[model samples]
Target: MLWIPIDRSLDIPLIRQVYQQIRERILNGDLQSEEKLPSTRELAFELKVSRNVILEAYDQLIAEGFLVTRRGSGTFVAKGTFLEKRVVPNHALNWRENKTDAANIIDFRSGLPALDLFPRKTWAKLSHAIWNDTSHSMFGYDLPEGRPELRQALARYLLKTRGVACHPEQIVITSGATQALTLVSRLLLSPNDTVIMEDPITNDIQTIFKTTGATIFPIPVDEYGIKTALLPENKKPKLIFITPSHQFPLGGTLPIQRRIQLIQYSRKTNCYLVEDDYDSEFRYEGPPVSSLQGLEPECVLYVGSFSKILSPALRIGYLVLPLQLIEESRRLKWFSDLHTPSVEQLILARFIDEGYLERHITRMKKVYKKRRDYLMHCIKTTFSNEVQVFGYSTGLHLIVEVTNFHFSKEKLKQIEQCGVKVYQVEEHTIEKDKHQNQLILGYGHLNQEEIKEGIARLHVALYK
Candidate 1:
């Protein structure tokens, strides 16, 4: 007699359980070819399940060619039904065991906004209104270029704020700046193509471009941004990636002279400049810096996202591409995920149109400014002349260069064990050892108390 186990405690249907067990046995070669199965009535009687359950299971197996029956004979396992099972390594178990808990540590990582300050009430109100009045067509797939409503609103806002000049037709909505860079790499790069980028850029950006199999020509940046004079004259790169308004990790605004040089170089070489204008709106100094895109819209592919200004969770960013690349970009975007979520786009469109986004940024600017000031004050009091702060005029994070000190891997681990976490500037540098003493400390998400305690702990970790 062929026996199959049944348990009443399981939520699965009796027919499914029976079907799965028999299929597993057949696939594992436990039941050989042409092996006879017990009659449905006998199996149902033995397993204490309904006859109909056994009949359904057998019928399904027969339909799937796992079982066959003769005119007057009972069911038999089909030939060639067995398959060898392969073992998959449990990599996630090791990763989970080694993961660090963030709750206990005062983390000062960059690019994180204050989640508590997000305009939740306004967003909820707009979301409710949008869903209530949404058109039937919105339930279907949207254009790959994104909703024109949001694009139009962004075009106007970018023009007024960042001096970016473009119509909604040039804008292609993306999941975030990461996706924008990925798409740009796909559009402009081929294997072994040359590209130029800052030496100490965000590691994620470096990884994105490297995945395209392009050769990255690293240009060193200073207090003013990328050294445009260092750009290779003989090399004709396909793309030049930059963070002009505020350089990542180092936080230097590219000067107008360098900006013009970049434009001239791109035009001469017929290459595209990808301008990432991230977190330029929160400049604490004079007026927000005008984008490199506005200088030469034809040569620049402008990338902007709400990830830094508002919240990263929104996953809404856009690329203001040159007119020539717009169609191909739309096609590539369609091939990638088939468009960003439509409902959020509609809600954000309303949010921007009603001046809520501006108001929120205005409010957060003051809050972030205060936090930035407090963090600076705490660092000054704790470290005194031992550290010099750089790039505090704009953006959410600033660089602190520790005098005559290098943040080695062991030192960083020691700092983390002391209940504080900080990022090393060397982590973002392509040619390391130059920025070994500098640390990128972000203050946008931290409160004054946490900032004070974190600095105090860091001081002890460094000096002790």
Candidate 2:
């Protein structure tokens, strides 16, 4: 039996202080279930406090249903209550990747930036300027939607960079695109609503849809991205989400022809299409792909993030909604964490105003272009005529198809034991046997030296 002591020297009431500690210990599993707690008299004696304080604390916990009195059973721990365990995170492994494990050997996980190459000097200056010059509003809950300057800056930047025609009034800031998805899911979806997502999309999207209770329907994607023809006609969806600019994992551009068709699909079905222009700013080849949002401003919800282009730590993301939904979206944003942090929003607004973001993104595009080409070259030279890779012309990743090899969880475990890590395309699928023979390789964050070394190690892993 363990008892917590409350110090009498503290200004905080002994009952409150004692209650908080015991509550946290139980919730965090430090106090095991069915473990008998100390009697109120014993706890008061050890702490040198009035027995009333200990009694009060225990009574509060019991009132809150965190503890239960079992009559003669001596207050046994409550069984099958909500507080004990929550949020079981997934740890599934995909075998088609077969890249070298990160702990032992380098791995090419997608959507990561070569953070070592980020511009720290410029950011330090911006951070200093924002703190020194910003008003008191910068310290408080600014606006749930976003800071006026940051929203306007992002509005202008999106137009200039990605051809997204948006106004500050229509842009609602989010913590990141993931949080954007979380809030958007709640804002847009009702129970049992259908959601259209890319086949073999990021696994996190699958988790998001599941959590939201949205019945996700996989839309087939090709080299040019989501096939508008493959969209389900019988099951009308509430929302359709896609990475049209640079398709995730597969790297297709969802060309203008398909973009127009997708918008038409949304119009016909009376649904909204959520376009995630996640990494379009970092395209290595051709002119930047035109965003689907630019096609039909009224029907498409545009989402953009700084994680890939600027830095993930910034955690700044924005959603451009059509004016019709702006009021509804704003009301929801007011309740969800109020708003994003003001310091970053202020600093970033200044950074965009000063053209620092433009210059940095321009420089990074060229650097990433070199790295992407080098990877393609190595694969072409090494594989010779053996493997076929798709969507390497843009974005942070490309898929390599293996017709000869079979990917299984047991094989993934074998590769893991060998100290290699890779993501199989199948890991992202809701429908099985889709993308079973494909591997999504991420080289966006790796430099030339790291890329060559990692690919070489991957070859050795599979062959050996």
Candidate 3:
């Protein structure tokens, strides 16, 4: 006999409850394919439910294809109803444990900020205030772009800090830089559309663009940044993606001359440019550069995120879109997620409005610069004239080019066996051979002592 338990107190109707449970059983493979279910009369008697209720439940299941009924026989479980279960291998679990829980391993992975220094108390206070104090309407479905308060706060903050000229209406809050890039790719590109990107770009960035069915044109980057002169003349691309402030892995800042050329190229070719100013806030040595969007707001779609400065878990980033693309992007955002969470948006807005974000950035800049200096000092002391470091003095990471050293998988495994975790820059490169001897060292998450010790361990791992 089928165990059919019906609760009269449940908000869900009795018919729906029965239908859902049976469907779950079928999908979970508890009910074998083509197995006959108990007759309605028997089920109704077993549960003490009316014949009408049992009939209704069985009818729903039959209608939805969870069960099939033959006129002469009984209802049976549908074939092909069971879902495939996900299985995790033991070795994969072990790898994850070692990567996450192993002690004494110092990681120099890029794109991570100093999570230890985030102002938790202030953030909690703001979050509490927003939750308890804000209106009930805030908890409900709001605008697709974002909460108005957060968008307004972002407009003011961007203008004051990065010189990005934009109104609150032009801002669209996103989950993070990843979503921002995704929105742009979906809206702008069609299948087979051509896009120009830095040669050794981040894997996620490359994947997102590729998923749009776009063909990528890889441009070689140097110590000065993307070689703008080498962009194919007369070959008009649909879009150009760049990390101008600090190039990923390579750490080169695009020169003003090249930036101007890019803007002019965009204007002449009528192609859009995506300026991902991911870590422009952490410039240690030079004056902070303004976003390219400020130069030609109509031609460039600027992307900014708090992941590097605040916490990546915040899932808060914004896109300052061109006037023409505003409505379409917002519509796409609506279709994708409706909106970012209202509570988080409210908390971030309060954080920015109350000046907590600025104060935090100011304090962290000094700390990060100190850490950067220590890492640079340690590398110079250990390697002497044998190594050259690129993408230095700014952002969270640097690229070290060691003479005659190739970070093959076996070599990386050997380094890992020594309890140090450093990444090869070649991992991000499209043409891996070009950056075979270089490694990307992100120092933002590590302290001064960890930086020194990690470098020493790496040296020992290589030469010992």
Candidate 4:
């Protein structure tokens, strides 16, 4: 092990500092894969730090994928992870140099939880109780289909809350909705099968769709969700994916009549509808929009996640599948990590069983409703008639159409620097320049203070 300097005066602990250094080294290729690392005691003594500090650092490294420990064989650097650190002279970071700088600025990004307001105390109590009850059985490998109790609880939640029809047997748990989409794309889609998607949705999903080698057809979206009128008649696509429950970014709920039409089309076309119910819980105008999965279960693959409502880190989500697709999805899930963690599922089971989740959703609904109202009020008070916000009734975000102002990328960068952030509608489009005057503002995570101040700064950026 190399000697690492310990900074006693820094607020960060020596263990964390050492961990970061080693991780950076391993990621950079200073340390090769499967190479033996120095023992904790030896490294501690050599670096003149306590042995416990070294052990703690190693523990964290192991928890992440930085290092692996073998019983009686000592720890070694992780393989296939040296890219994070190695520098190529001419290479430049292309993803986003502004990620760091952007993070430092106040954010208005969508699909985020209001972490400051979640009921941690109540969740802790349920978690502790679940641990006491199932710590023994949870130590073994779990069912690939996920924890039975959580599935059962989710079944009840769907019936009462979302009007979805399904039993626990048809429900499969995965890491999150992203994983759900990945496996669905793999299982249902053949190499050249066609996928019909909303033209202006999150680019993150595009990665998964493209990797499947599937032919993607981008259908146009309007204020009433995906325009059924614009759906391609010639392609006969294999599957159609939509965010019907308060369409992402644009925030329009697919109306019930349109949902029925989509369902009818799915049945007639023999195609599956991947309904991503991402943020339907926080609608400020009224009760949550009814899911398309309710219209037709066989044609609709309903997906939901607790990321926005509870926390993203939970990494727990459910998919309601038709019986025809259930076995294939289970097999895909088995190959994809076998199953999700049982302890968290067990805790969530108890959480829902005892009505904790319902309570949490009710509480969050009020919190987000208030935030949504404040967002509307802020737009009305600050920008007034200058900016027109779309789909303001439901979901976490609203689409602001800047009337007569040039909403250029350079202007957006300036607005980002001015301490407010938003999604460029143009980026979501397959073709550019269509949504030049539009911006998607997410207000779920921020409180009254951040929302007000962020919008005020945004106004300064806009008017200037």
* Regions of model 1 farther than 4 Å from truth: 10-16, 87-96
Writing each residue's lDDT as its tens digit, candidate 2 over 1-464 gives 46566677899898999889888887777776776778887878888888998889889988887778877766544544335566655644433664544457566688888799888999899899878887876687678899999999988888987889888999999999988887678878987999999886888977886787789998878888888888888978999989888888788888778888888889899999998888888776677877778888998888888998878999999999999989888888888888899898888898899999989988988888888889888877766766788887777787877667766887756655555456788888767787777777888787787777666656665667
The order of the candidates by TM-score, greatest first, is 1, 3, 4, 2
* Number of backbone clashes in candidate 3: 1
TM-score, one value per model: 0.92, 0.78, 0.82, 0.80
Tens-digit per-residue lDDT, 237-287, candidate 4: 889989987877687778777777787777778899999998787777778
- Write the residue-wise lDDT of candidate 1 on 59-154 in tens digits: 999999999999898899999899988786788456545345678799998889999988899999999998899998999999998999999999
- At residue 369, what lDDT does model 4 achieve? 79
Which structure is stronger by lDDT: 1 or 2? 1
> Candidate 2: which pairs clash?
100-420, 100-421, 101-419, 101-420, 101-421
- Backbone collision count in every prediction? 0, 5, 1, 3
Best by TM-score: 1
Per-residue error for 4 in candidate 2, Å, reads: 15
- For candidate 3, what is the TM-score? 0.82
Which candidate number would show the highest lDDT if scored against the true structure?
1
Clashing pairs in 3: 251-391
- Where is the poorest 10-residue window by lDDT in model 1? 92-101
